[model samples]
Target: MAIPSKTIKVFEELLESPQNRLVEQAVESGRIPIGYSCSFVPEALLMADKLFPLRLHAPGLAGTELADNYLSCFVCSYTRGLLEFAMDGRYDLLKGWVFVPSCAHMQRLYDNLEYLQKPDFNHILDVPRKVNNDTLLWMTEELQMLADKLAHHFGADMSDVSLRKAMEQWNDFASVVQSIGDLRKKPNPPINGAEFHQIVMASLASPKDLILPYILDFKKEIEQREGIKNSRARLMLVGGHLHDPEFIRVIESQGCVVVADRFCTGTIPGFKTIDINNDSPYKILAEYTFAKTLCPRMMEDFDRRLNTIIDTVKEYNADGVVLEIIKFCDLWGVDAMPLVSALRDNGIPVLRLEREYCLGGEGQLRTRVQAFIESMGK
Candidate 1:
C-alpha cells in the first residue's frame, strides 16, 4: 500500500505555520518555550522542567528585506532568513533564546539578536573548538551554569533528576527516529528521502509529547508500506543547515534515492540515541555532544568527521554523495575543499552544490543532480 496521506499531512501542516500548532498548544498548557539556533545546544537541558526547545527555521521565507537593514549581504541566507523572521515578530512567543558559536556567521547572528531584539533570557552556551579533556570539563561546567541560569530565571527544575528524566525522554524519541532511519538502509526502503526529511523536521519542531504519538502511527504505516523500486542511484547527502525537505524532494525528483544524510537536520548523528551511563547527566551530555560526527566547526575533528561520512556511505550502500552548503558560509566552504578531495580519494563520487538558503533554481539543481546520477552511470 502507498504511504498514508493523513500521516504526511499532519507533518506538512505543522511545517507551514511560523509558530507550530503544537508549540502554541504547549505554550497554552503552561509550558515555556525556548528558541535555539544550532544542533550544538543540548536540547534535553532546555527541556529540563517546564522548558521546551524550539529549533528555529524560516521555511517559505520569500525575502530578507528587514534582515538586510542590519545584516550585510555577505551573511548566509539561513541567518538572514531567521533575522527576517525575527524582525517580522515570528518568534516573539519564545520567552528565552540560546545559541552556540558554531561558526562566525552564527556568532554574527547572535550579535544582531542581542542588539536588535534584546531578548529577555538570552545566553550563549560557549562550545570549544577542539574536543579534549580540558574542553570536556569546560563544556560540562558550561552546561551546569546554563542549567543554573535557567532555574534562576524561569524557576525551571534543573536538578539531576529532572535533567536525567529529560535525557531519557529524548533518548526514547531518538530510538523511534533511529528505527525510521534504519528503514532507509533497506535494499528498497519503504520511505523516500523527502518524506523522511519532513518527518524529522516535524519531530524537531514539535514537543516530544505532542508529536511522538503521530510519529509512532506514521512509523507503523511506513514499516508496512511497499519499498520504492524506481530509484536509479542511492545518495547520501552531507552539508549544513538543510532544514528544507523540498531540497531533498528536488534531488529525488531527478531519479535518485537519498538513502542517508549527514547534515544539521539529518538523522545519522542528530537523532542518534545518547548512551545512558553512570556519569553525571551534564557530563554525559557533554561527552555525547562532543563525540558525535558533527559539522566542520570542530577544528580538530576533521578525520573523525571524514570517517563518519565514509562509514555512512558504506552503511547506506550509497553510490554517491551530494554535499550542499548555503552561499557565503565560510566554515563549510573552507571545509569542502579538503572533503571533496578526500572523498574522491576514497573512491566516492561527490557533487558539490552551493545555493541560497531559500529553495530556488530548481531547474539548475535538477540539471546538476541529473549529471551527478549520469556520472555514477546509474
Candidate 2:
C-alpha cells in the first residue's frame, strides 16, 4: 500500500532531528523534555505532568570524532553516536536525563554526558541483575525515589494520581501502536517492515499526545488499503538499538517480508500494554519493567529469553530469525553465541549479522539476505 503523503511527512519530520516540529511544539507548550535510553527505564515516570521522555538516538551521525576522545574505538557505535550527538549540542532540547547502566558502553556514555552537558536533571536508576521478590521491592523503592527526585528537581507531579494518569496515557498510546503492529500478522500486511519501522521510530521520538492523532489517521488509511503482495520468506529481526529504517529496507529489498521484530527500538515488548491492576503504580511499574523480554545482560534469564525467541518465531510464522548485533556490543556479542546454537538446536533457522550504528554495506547485507532466503526455499 502507498502510504499517505501527509502521514509519511509527519513521520519524516519527526525523525529529521532530535528536536522535531512536534517536540518544539510540546516544549513551547511548557512541557519539559526528559531524555532516556534503554527500554528498561519506566517511561511512565518520565511522562509525568509537564514532562515527556525523549528516547535518545542519532539516526544519521556521520562521524564520532568528538565521542572518540571520551570513548574507546571498540565501544559500539550506538553509544558513541549518542555521545557525539550530545557533544555536538544536538540534544540541547533535553532538559534532563535518566540512564540505566545496561552495559559498560552505556555507563561510559552516561559518564561522559554527566561530565559534559550536566543537564538540570542527571540520574541513574540501577536495575537489578536478577528478578526476585527482594529485587522487585528494591525496584519499587527505586522508582519511588526517582519520582520523589523528579518532583524535587523539576516540580513534576509524581503523586499517585499523576503517575496513574501517565500510565493510562501511555497505555492508550501503546494500544494504538499495538493495533497498527498487529497488521503484520496477516497473510499479506498493509504495512511493510520499513514503513512500520518509520512509524514506530517516530512515535518513540515524539510526544504521545502530539503524534497519536496522526498515527490514528494513518492507521485508518492503511486499514482500508491493499496488503502488499509478492514477498519471499517471512523473517523476524532481533537485535539492539537499530534506529534506521533504511536497514530494514535493505533486508526487504532481498524479497523477504520482515513480519516481526524483537529489537531494542522495535515493537514486541516495548509496545506491549502496561496491564494495570489493583496495586500501587510504583509496584505495577516495577513489575512491568522487570518482566520485559530480557536483554542479553540479564545473565540468569538466558533460558527464558531463548524460549521467547523460539516462541516468537512460531507466533509470527517467520521462516527464520535474523539476529543482528552492533559490532563490539559485548553483551549481545556474547549472548549471540549461545542464542545461535540454541535456536538451531530447536530447529530454527538463524542468520547472524554484525552491523554498525549508521547503516552501511547494503550490497553485502542484501547479498546475505538473498542467499538466506534462497536457502530457506531449498
Candidate 3:
C-alpha cells in the first residue's frame, strides 16, 4: 500500500508550522520533551516514557551577535547557529535539551546553555567518550537517572513494557524506511528520489504508526510502477542538515537523482536501530546511543566519514557526489576540501553548494547541479 495523496499534503502542511506543534502537543499533555544532538540518542525509548525526544538541529540563524558574547569565534558554526537561535528565543518551546560530548565545540555550547540566564528546563547530558562495558553500564545508569528526572517533572510513570513497545514500533518504522532507501539503488526505482526525501522528512515529525504505513504503501506503489524510465544521473548528497524536502526537489529538478546522502538530518542519523537482546532497557538505549557513527562535527577523523560516503556512492552506483554545504557550517566547510579530493582521486566528480535553509537559493543551485549531471552523462 502507498501513502494516500492526502497524507503527503498534510505532511507538507505540518512542515510549515512556525513552532513544532507536534512537540508542543507532547509537552502540553504533561510529557517531557528532551532535545538531543547526534544520532546516538535513543529518542524512541524516550517517547515510550511519554517524553518527546526532539533532535536539536542547527537553527539557521541570521546573526551571531548573541552567540559571540558567550562562545569563541573558533567554535563550530553549527554550535554558534544554535546559540543564536536560543538567544533569539526560537526554540523556547523546548522543555529541556540533551547534549552529548560529540566535540569540544559542542561541549562548550552545552556549558554555556546550562549556566546561561535563560529557560529553567535546559540541561546538558554527559555522555561517555568510550563504548566499553564499563561505559555502557555508566550510560545505562545515567539514562535511568534522566528518566527518573523526566518522570518527576512530567508527573508520569514509564513502564518497561511501554518502552519496549515503542522501540519495537520505531524498529518497524526504520525497516520500512530502509526498504525505501534500498529501492533507490535499483536501476528503475519505484519512487522518484525527490518524493522519497519528502516521505523521509515527513516521517521525522509524524508518529511511527502513521509513518510506517505511508512508507510501506509508497514502496508497494513504486513496485507497481516498475519499468519506468530512469534517465536522470544518480548522485549522492553529502553535507549538513537536509531535512527540507525543497532541497531534494531542487536537485531532482536539475535532472539528477539523489540516490544516497550522508547529511546530519538524512540517512546517517536515521539508519541505525536499537539492539533488542539486552534485558536492561536502559543498557540497550545506552549501547545504541554511544556506538553509533559520529558526524563531521563529532569526529576528528574525516577520512572515516569520507570513506563511508565513497562506499555509499559505490553501493548506489552514483555517478557524482553533491556536497550540500550550509553556509557558515564550519564542520562541513572544513571537511569539504579533503572529502572532495578523496572522491576525485577515486574518479568521481563532485559539486559543492553553500546554502541557507530557504527556497530562494534553488535557482542558482539548479543550474550548477544540472551542469554536473550533464557532465556525468558525457
lDDT of 3 by residue, 1-378 (tens): 122354456456545532455556555776665666656566676677556566654323456789989988766556776787777776777777767675677778888887674555554556665557787798888788776766676654656777787778777787778877888788765556667677766566544453466667656666666432545788888876676677787787765667786776676535666678758778777877664554665444466677788888889888888988756667678878888898999898999888764444677888898888887773
The sequence of per-residue lDDT tens digits that candidate 2 reaches over residues 105-203 is 999988888798777788888888888899999999989998899999888989889988999999999899888888888888888888888889998
What ordering of candidates by TM-score runs from best to worst?
A: 1, 2, 3
The segments of candidate 1 whose C-alpha lies over 4 angstroms from its true place after superposition are 1-4
- In terms of lDDT, the poorest run of 10 residues in model 2 is 1-10
Q: Which pairs clash (backbone N, Cα, C closer than 3 Å) in model 2? A: none
* lDDT for residue 97 in candidate 1, whole number 0-100: 87
Candidate 3 minimal-lDDT segment of 10 residues = 1-10
Q: Which predicted model would earn the best TM-score?
A: 1
lDDT of 2 at 366: 93
Model 1: lDDT of residue 158: 93
Tell me the deviation in Å of residue 371 in model 2. 0.8
lDDT for predicted candidate 2 compared with the true structure: 0.88
